[model samples]
Target chain A: MKYHGGHFICAVWKLDIRLWQLLIMASLLLAGVWFRDFSLYPAQIAFTFAAGLITQAIFLRLFKLEQHGFLSATITCFGLCLLLRSSALWVHPAVASLVMASKFLIRPQGAHLFNPANLGVVLGLSFFPETWVTSGQWGQDLTTALWLIAAGFFIARNAKRLDITAYFLLFYASLFLVIRVAWYGYTLPVFFHQFQNGALLLFAFFMISDPMTIPRHHKARILHAAVVAVLAYIWQYQLYWNQGIIWGLFWATFLVPLWNHLFPAPRYQWQALSGEHT
Target chain B: MTTRLIFLLLALSISQTSQAFCGFYVAKADASLYNQASQVVMTRKDDKTVLSLMNDYQGELKDFALVVPVPQVLTEGQIHIGDAKLFKHIDDFSAPRLVEYHDEDPCQPPVMYEKMMSAPMPTAAMPQKAKSDKSLGVTVEAEYTVGEYDIVILSAKESDGLEKWLQASGYKIPKGASAALKPYIKQNLKFFVAKVNLKEQNKTGLKFLRPLQFAFESPKFMLPIRLGMINAKGPQDLLVYILTEKGRVESSNYQTLKLPSNMDIPVYIKDNFADFYKALFETQVKKQNLRAVFTEYFWNMGWCDPCASEPLSYEELKQLGVFWLNQNSNAPQVMSGGGVPVQVTRLHVRYTPDSFPEDLSFQETRDTENFQGRYVLRHAWQGKPEQCEAAKTYFEQLAKRHEQEAKTLAELTGWELSDIKKKMNLNDAPDQESTDQWWKKIW
Candidate 1:
């Protein structure tokens, strides 16, 4: 039991959950490009990764922050590749750099202000004429939707932020049910159709539940999730706009500082994710 | 070689027979490919939208029924009957094209390239009805006779009352339609009901009903298509021509996929391009499981590379409900890139009731990149395979290319590989006895 070789193996076994996150995100992107016919080109995706990682390197060096790592930035790169679409080549790298820079530059307190990829997409959709989000890029196919939900659940749990995802989805689904089915008289399938969306699930588990951005207090996080849900609903149904969830998260970001101030909780550390040793 | 003029025949889905260039251009695949296909042209800018709906109703004129839920009650000036030729032109312009380019002589450098386009298909549909009465919770907002048709606009408080009013007015209402109409009614949408008036129809002396168009202002950028699925027997084909100011229009809810395009196919497909296209589309829809909308074409109004049909003129564009075109006399030459900036997006969907649970919603993006469903055919030079070293090498590569083309055709259409090989006549090539054969060197 005291063998040095055994100790080495155990250390390797306790690899960071961020590596698992990178793996899951990479697989989802690959599956979308190959089977789902995502319009993302390989060169564009490479540019995204290059821009994200390079920016992360620059920021880490600028602050000389040895504790920060490339894993989170790389994850944001995958998020950008999965959500953002553009005919022009430059939009991807530009968006990735802006969002990665946000991680370091946009800190409100000790935590980053917005989920990098979510804010990147919102800014791209707002500012860039060539860029757009293919919210329906992943069709409402059962296999893809199930894979997203299952993968999202895994990561949300490992990151200790499953509460936000669960609450956000619950609140959003109930809103759809009440307005679309009960009030508007749409059938149940119409309501369920929205659930099968890959974009919505991706936002719930990945964007809204971003542990670094959401409220640190448990109760505050739940309230944050519901606020995002209602804002997203209003953006989509009332305004008849696209990228509702993305904008929803972007607008909800302003309240995070207030939530953290009111409901104080201990600061989060990457090592906390190792509690379950996933 | 410098002066040789090798005529390239472009079916343009253009020439049904005569591959004549510098002459007449006809569309290849018209909307007659399907049984019950309905075509709609929607041109919108800001809050103003003009929608034109085309129906090929072969049934008894009295039984032809169309009830569309609209955002506002359309006035008489808002309604107009349009020429069917406009639909034909737009369909031809956006149809998936089969372009054929002949290879230059192996001994000489290449020069010429030609391209052309084709048609639209049909789908299944049922009927809808409505009326206006205070007691029945239906208000007759307006009535009009735009062309050879009687039109009525009715605002209703409930779906059942609207259905009853239509039924009593002798309109054919499909069963369970009230359920489908409920959502639109609750959304406060008024109904635009139209039926053919046989007496006025005889005066026009046209065999088919002209397309119906209406212009209105609304924030909703959507097509009320779910109501048409009330009594749908099976999946139906819908061709939507969306003209916008800045960029392309895509479904906000459903996946907007582009058909696999721009590949080389066997020259034999030239004879049966229509059937080839049908197979290509059917196979793609099967792959998507009828769950996605396909973008057949998206291009600016300025020009076409190899025009499938002559670009729609400004007058014709206006007739097709492009309200944004300026009244300047110079705008008539929109083909010169000087007219009002309009981009057309042709979206095709083979939709079933189960796959499409809700009405389609759309959004316009600021992307002007042009795309089309383009297929290519490469014809070999007529030079002798033994004419020169280049000729022999060309012949060798040609045989291999044909083999690959056969495989591609099978993959695209989900056809039998063996059958494609048989059709390609891959057995009797002269390359079999070429001097480069390894057996000759051994001897």
Candidate 2:
């Protein structure tokens, strides 16, 4: 069937990538909860989304800003539910609210400064005594890993930001290989085992590859990804900190404005891309 | 009135004793129960680590030698032979316990289980030698005798040199040990080699070798499990008792699994707790492909639920390398559940060299949640049948519960379901119920 011009272009290009993101994230959540014994309760998940959405709504009304959508808030909630673990139920919603509020409260240049999920996790771990991130929750399972990579690639492709994911994974994996195999005299399988991690893959495909939070310019984004990868490797292997990807991303967000200033490009608009194929 | 008051006081004392226990402790599975198991007590705060390696070597004292990778050269003051009782204390305190709870009378007003308490029963539970040469690129950093062992700290340039030096010094180094030594050597880690000094051993008047304890400062919070795996016969069991200031210590490299706990099992398990525990562990190890670090227990060092034994005294903890216990001047003499500074996380791993390639890297999580590999054995009420319907219902449910317990045991130990049913004697009631039940085989 033949389609109309602009509508078809919109359908093909700017098809609310958040919709795909939500679907992917929801599937991941379901898979984690069902298959992996990911130490999450249904009530905790419900409370997290409720708290995040309510906080986002309140902030939008208070600031008198045009309510873009709850899509971003939903994504952030899913990310929090997927990552953060606590013995107490209240930590989930409390961290969710603070993370959502930060998105509105700590706007550096009319843009959300930190990735809400990353900020919430880092802050939750640092501030609260009970909260933690279970990096080994996703054990080295080949089938689950391949599925995540495929799904992540599809989502990134839809967002038209696969380059960042590709670059981050490449740099991060290569650095791990170098350290383990070249420097440490470990076997080749040890280098490959690092790639089979579900946490690292999730961070690369979902967290670090967030199109909105990363640098706008392509070159700046590449540089930003590389910097985060290096910092994460250092934070993990050198400083021996947990949630290295999160801490690295949290620190690297400070440099986004610098990268923006150095290599200025049009701010990424969710609805700007139209399928007038390049 | 005076007699009544005296009776009340007597009752109060009895109730206090009952309430003190979380459950009726029946049996325990400690480190001493397992063959070929090595226990290591690691007291870590910041970069400072005090590791006490418990030697379970049962062979001739002369043949026993230990080679461990250390981050720095340990001086004579840094190395000491620790009291063996420290391990026994920690092991008894943290062992996976079997707790029994007796059922209450169904007709009576719901009284606490403590009121109907029954008496709890107690249940019973590496090498090196070295010679140095400049051509072999082996350097002996320090040499000393600590207690019954002669200790030497060696730093090597290559694996071959390390192997040759050890062989020349009359230490029986395992084949392929050189390959294992290479990684640690390349990382610039020094080796702590200990051999039994027969003259010193005779002086101690002890039949068993004492645990070797050493202190060091390093950025790496890891146990070099790879070196231990070099010449392991089958899979080796390593029980790590990590004493940290904050929270749980889990393997960063491999998955750290909390052993399945708090489930009711066949009451017969109380008699065979050791066998049951071995089977349960073997089943889980098989399920995880022998690649998981199972957390047998994690709790505040001061207290326990259904405690297998008493909490270690401050002096005992200090003897076990807990240096920070005295930091808080106002710490309590009698330890309880909460407000204890030191957290004990016990991790058990049945790992082979192939399954675990890297050394066990650890990260102390902020999760202060208490966990233990505790099994429950609910003792059914031995009372006779009464005219009341409640008693009848109770008996019926008890049978069903017994069947469930049998099934749970079957799942846990991979025992035959029929065999467990026979052992539990839950066959007659369940069979009758199954025949009459409408939902049974309806599909």
Candidate 3:
């Protein structure tokens, strides 16, 4: 989007998709707190931002990556606040700093390897015994799932990263259908019930469709998503580990560079100073 | 706040449970409440798990049979008969409690005081077998007689042979049991079949069947609910008590919600606590469309805030098969009387086969936050409203408080609002008439 002239609509049209992402995430958090009865506190959210933004600033100066902005950090903070739940207050801030630091530390080919929020959840669940991902906190409510999808459609449309989300959902639902519905004789409601999960939908639209961490080429991204689906199915169903959806993406991040090398394309940029889509 | 021990009625409902954890009480007995409600106490740490199934089979001993899927065949040493009293005590300890508080004199400054009318606080809280056959593609791995029960472990190649084998063995499984049993068979899970041994049952001379306890190690932390749904008349209720070393336990596949607690209700509910609770639970089940698991109580066994039937003692904990703690080396070093902070989470669910198609999968989370279904009752002082300025304020507050309590009860139980107001004598209250502008008061 570019500023064609000094018109209000043109200015609004020039808004980056990430700004919509930022607004949607904040609204979703509020909706979760109000409607879903999320067991989250304002202090935890405050601490997460306090830690995440500070870590982002320190890394920007320390690593001389000032070209990047705080939008991603803010979005990651919302993700962490939404996904990670802990009884202790300090776990929020501590994990926030570590996750923000990971964005800079765990990079390959000058791009972040793991989604910052995905890595946060993975590390928190793996290392901190006191922290956990409440996967079932978001019940399989149809209305909530639809709301996520509607919001996702609007935001992901502008980002032009809908392929991975679509691919991930297809592959994941196929695995679920084949195993639970077809092989195990579970009713189709059970299969559909699994997809109506708000957490899973949120992962599809917000987490997996993240343009930076995903492969640049379209085909490679789809393949990457399929790999995630299979690995996540094995991790959750076969290996019986908790939070396998996020762990699926966490494990698949190692293959991003390989996918990029296999099918090459230009790196994604959120901002083009001269205003270009690519 | 001064405490008043007026009534200690715990109205928490303990579902009379069996099934979907697998098998049926078979047939030809009173298929009523006990058939619909099944209770299981599962304790886990690491890969080790001990499951105690409460078999409240209110039927003839010959007809009572239970089939459950185990990850592997259990040896004779792995099975034992559990004390029925343990289930009762654990139920009472975890049931929702009603606490009462009396309003102090408004003229005097606030003072903290404690009063107890009774020494003991009351709470309302409230399984088996297997076999094998060959050439029918069913293999009976092992059989044993363990105290009033004949247990057989079966590994079936397919559900058809297993169903036939069970029927041939005089187990009288329900129709369509094969379809229900195929998933487990496909998963290669061994089924443990238990039947009441008439002679051994007679030797015990006890009317009720003792709980069946099994100790095993499996990485799959889940309970199969599909098989039990085959025997369902409508919606079945399941009550699970999870004891874990790390923290609270929640179903990974189903949403686990905490029941509304610590709310004030009308004083008349003290006597009608049981009916109140039943209505509240039904209302919640209906509201969630029978798709969620409700956490009634979650607290560490070391201590409780109001101390509902003294936290399970170390000996009692061991009896429940909590394997992480050692009796000798793990003595309490601090005031937390118990060792290794055992957390007990009570989960209840009401579901039909349609609503819940999959087995309940659970994961232990690192949440040590204490929660309980403690309803409060506030007793208004009998002083006249003309005594002092604070007295006038207290009387006004009391009327509004009563009104608020009435609304809460109606909302919580889905009761008729007018009927609740009639029960509280709230419609005729003079203060209600004084506030004619509803919009002005709402703000």
Candidate 4:
């Protein structure tokens, strides 16, 4: 029954990673709103969090789920705030509520089927005409890019999800390089310009690399990254669709169940592994 | 005196009283505020786009030529000569506006001010064959004489061959144009080469070039700015007026930022609004390192809150390539009886070759939020001491407000604070008697 020093340290480490993610997300939102002049209103952000947390509480109560906490909801709220834009006040909260509800409702084999933020954005865009994401809102600036990459490395390292992030960036960047530089004969700066987008970096590190929603096995994860990258490239370059990354990830989500079935691995638990990389 | 040919489009004023509580429009800061600014009006609905290109090319008529990259070879029917007046209407409607509001009487109900200050306006070629050999790898896909333009649509097999073909035909293209043309050629985009047809020009009897418009259906909603930048002197200004059915159109690759708007500056700006906007824009471009596309105005064509110019009429909107307007006669209206809802997003970009390497690509967002680069000038209440306490207190607050406005102008234009204060005639320095009293006490 005695608690050991290692046990105390492990408990602290588990909370530390979530704290880091929260801090990074909050700072990025602040930078975006303050310096980048994001078209998000204060009331929209407040309502989004209220709707996300309230819906999460309601779903927890109705489902009689025991593991009820604010950490996951907080992460989802930040993600929504970072990506979703709406002139109307209702869209953010409405989308946030649906996203939080999906975590409980859309359960497949006791795991959330889709990333909560990603689902919310895709659905919001499809259903509401007023809601859209501005991918170019975060233009490629050297200072901001370095800042995001540095912070993203810390979060990815702590989460042990760097494999997916690395693979996703590699695949996406190589395609851009080929199209902009080699085939088109554009200068190297054009290639760098496309790759340095902050939205792409944010997507690579934060949204698509969500641990719980991704495939459980490493091989499945790599495949998932490659497929999403290819689809995103085609969507943006070939089909000329906006929000290609979001669309790619949304379509790629259905493959998770198949991937997990083929290559089974232990289910990821936030508490079981500390900030230590596996 | 050398004869200066100035073609003026008669300004048609459509006066309609606005019901919205937004301030009344006093003056406009149009693309004319910038020198060498090229105006392009692009109306897109889904995959269909109609682009109207107008430039102030004041050189010899024979030397005037424009070569643009088209997604497909445009037929003669796709090309039309647009009325220069339509550009004026859209520009007058969506140009960054200066609106005035009179400060109410401190002792009585408010009265809005009506005085306005007006500002001064700021005020491609071809290929040859020759090496007309079929083996030169250049194919002229289509050729036509539309309006006063001799148009040739070319699809090239290689950049070198295309450059050689252009040179052989006496199109005087810039030296580095081949490198710029390679990417568009690789993308299979046809080159739209146009030069003035002297015979047609003489028949038109107009000194200025009429805007050239082309309607095309392609999945790509982009403007090829790279080809234009090849021989650019220093920096070029492009005023892109985009009209979409749903919402705002924004640059996909570059940051699309709404210019600083809805700020109250000094009333003196009403007289010098042109100079103020020019300096303000220059400062913003420098601050962003000249790497941003600035949205000067985005509003529904149905109505304007402050009627900068009257909302373009249904006929005018149709002329600007709003093909969806006829189909959706019942499109959602922002204002009752204000015409069909067509969103106009006026984007102004000042780009150097270094700042912008790629052609500007755009996407129409579903955000229907209305925004405009509107600056306000509030005329202070001129009440006497015979009035009530409110009047007395208003003067005290007015001084502070004036100081704040001066600071804002300085910060926005990168002007010296001292110089702005001097210009503002901020003479509220500590009284000589008060200073002497303090000195007397010390002595």
Please give the DockQ score of every candidate, comma-separated: 0.38, 0.34, 0.46, 0.47
Q: Write the per-residue lDDT of candidate 1 for residues B78-144, one digit (tens) a residue.
A: 9999999899989988787777766778887655544333211112222344344677798989988
lDDT of 1 by residue, A1-278 (tens): 23266766656546777777788899999999998888778878987887778778878889999667788899999999999988777677778988988888888887789899988888888898567888888899988889888998988897888999999999989998999899889999988788899998888888887788889999999999899999999999888877888888899999999999999998765632436433
Return the candidate ranking by DockQ, descending. Answer: 4, 3, 1, 2
Q: For each candidate, give its TM-score against the true structure.
A: 0.90, 0.90, 0.89, 0.90
What is the lDDT, from 0 to 100, of the residue A250 in candidate 3? 87
- Candidate 1 global TM-score: 0.90
Comparing only chain B with the true structure, the TM-scores of all models are: 0.86, 0.88, 0.86, 0.87
Compared with the true structure, all predictions reach lDDT values of: 0.81, 0.81, 0.79, 0.82
Please estimate how well model 2 matches the true structure, expressed as its whole-model Cα lDDT: 0.81
Task: Tell me the tens digit of each residue's lDDT in model 2 across A76-120.
Answer: 999999999876667787788889889887876668889889998
> Residue B21 deviation, candidate 3, in Å?
38
By DockQ, who's the top model here?
Answer: 4
State how far residue A5 of model 3 sits from its true place (Å): 14
Model 4, A33-71: lDDT tens digits are 999989888877887887788788878879887566778
Model 4: per-residue lDDT, tens digit, B186-222? 9898988888888999999999999999999989889
Native contacts present in each candidate (fraction): 0.62, 0.45, 0.53, 0.59
Off by over 4 Å in 4: A1-16, A271-278, B1-24, B109-132, B327-339, B429-443
